[model samples]
Target: MYPILFSFGSIHFYSYGLMIAIGILVAYYLAEKKIKANGIDPKRLEWLVFSILAGGFAGSKILYWITRIPDIGTDPTIFTNLGDGWVVYGGIIGGLVAGWFYCQNHGMNFWKTFDMVIPEVALAQGFGRIGCFLAGCCYGVETHAWYAVVFPEESLAPAGISLFPSQLVMSAYDFGLYFFLEWFSKKKKFNGEVGAAYLIAYSFGRFVIEFFRGDMIRGVVNGLSTSQYIAIATFIAGIAIIVIGRKRFSQSNK
Candidate 1:
C-alpha cells in the first residue's frame, strides 16, 4: 500500500489522489469503450466523466462538511482537518445527482447512461478502496486476526492496535461486484438495470462493511453511522428501481 507516492522536499505525492485519478481514468476508459454499444456517441463519455468528477467530489466534500457541523462547535481544530471529513457515500450521492443533472441538461437519456456506466463505477470503487488500504484509512476495529495490520503512520489507525482490513474488505467486495455485474450486463431488461443492481449490491456490501469499520465516525441520524443510513436508503432505492423497471418491461411486452 502506498500512502504517499513520493516527496519533493516539503511537498508530497499522495496515494489517495493518485489512486482516485487512476480510477477515474480507468472508469472513463471503460465508459468510452462501451458508449457506442449503448447506441450513443462515445464522445459524450467525456461529458459524463466531467459530471461524475464534479458531482462526486462536490458531494463528498459538502457532505463531509455538513456532517462536521457538530464537531465544529466542540473541536475548533475540525476546520483545519479537511481530510477527515470525506465519506465515500457522500461522493456517490454527489456524483449521481450531478451526473443526472448533466444528462438531463444535455438531452441525453439518463437511464441509458447510468446503465452504461454502472459497472465502471463499481470498478472505480475497487481501485479507490485499494487507495484507502494504502492510506490506512477506512480500516476496521481492533482485532488480533491473522490479517490484521498495525498502521503506525496512518492517521486513521484504531487506538494503536491492529484492526480488521476494512478497506481490503471493501476492495474485495467491489471486485466481486465488478465481475458479477459484468456477467449480467447483457441480461438486464432495460437501460438502467445494471445501475439498479449496482446500487443494491454496493449498498448491501457497504452496510456490512460499516459494521466492521473501527475508525472514528460521526452519526448523522439516530446514532447510526451516516454511511449505514445512506446504505439503507440506497438499498431500498435499488430495489425500487428493479421492481419498477421490471414492471415497465412487463407492461411493454404485453
Candidate 2:
C-alpha cells in the first residue's frame, strides 16, 4: 500500500485524496451526461452536487468522531488523529438530507433527482474503495485464505499481516451495484425505485463486507457493526419505499 503517492520536498501527494478526486471527477462526468440527456438543468445539478459533497464530508467526519467518543473519553488527544477515518453511512444520510432540502427549496422533484444521482454515487464509491486499498485503510481481518494481502510498513494496516482483501471485495461490489442499478433504472416502475434499490443493494453488500473488515475503527453493537444496523434499517426502508411508491402510482392511475 502507498499512502503518499509522492512527495515534492515539503509537499506530499496522498493517494487517498487523489483517488477520491478522480472518483468525483468520473462520477460528475457520468452525472453531467445523464443530466443533459434527461433535460435536467445543469446549473441546479451542479449546486445539488456541491451540497451533497459538503454535507457528506461533514457528516462522515462527524460520525467518525462519534465512533471514537468512547476512546476519546479515556484519551482526549486521540481526537488529534484526523488524517483518516470516515463512515460512508453517515455521508449517505447527510447527503440525502442536504439534497432533499435543496430539492424542496428549489421546487425540484426529490425522488427523480435522487434516482439519477445515486448510481453516480455508487460509481464514485467504487473508485474510493480502490483508494482505501492503496492507502491500507479499511483493511480486512487475518486470513489464511488464498486471497490475502500483506501490507508493507508504509501502509495504515498492521505491517506484514496477512489479511483478507475486504477493500477490493467492497470495491467490486460497488462497481457491480453501479452497473446493476444503471440497467435496472430503465426497467424500474416507480421514480424512487432505483434510489431505493441502491439503498437496499449497498446496505446488504456493506453489511456482509463488515464481517471481513479488519479495522475496528468502525464501532460495533451486539456483535454487529454500526453499519450492519444501518443496513437493516435502510433495507427495510427501501422495501417500504418501493411498496409505497407502487401503491401511490396505482392510486394515481386509478
What value of lDDT does candidate 2 attain over all alpha carbons? 0.91
Task: State the C-alpha lDDT per candidate.
Answer: 0.83, 0.91
10 residues in a row with least lDDT, candidate 2 = 75-84
Clashes of each: 0, 0
In terms of lDDT, the poorest run of 10 residues in model 1 is 152-161
Query: Per-prediction TM-score, please?
Result: 0.93, 0.96
Query: How many backbone collisions does model 1 have?
Result: 0
lDDT of 1 by residue, 1-254 (tens): 46788999999888877887788898888788888766778767887788887888778877877777877788877667766557888899999998899899889989888887888889898999888888878888888989987886545555467889999889989989988888888899987888999999999999888888876555636656888888999999999999999999999999
**Model 1: residue 200 alpha-carbon error in angstroms:** 0.7
Q: What TM-score quantifies how close candidate 1 is to the native fold?
A: 0.93
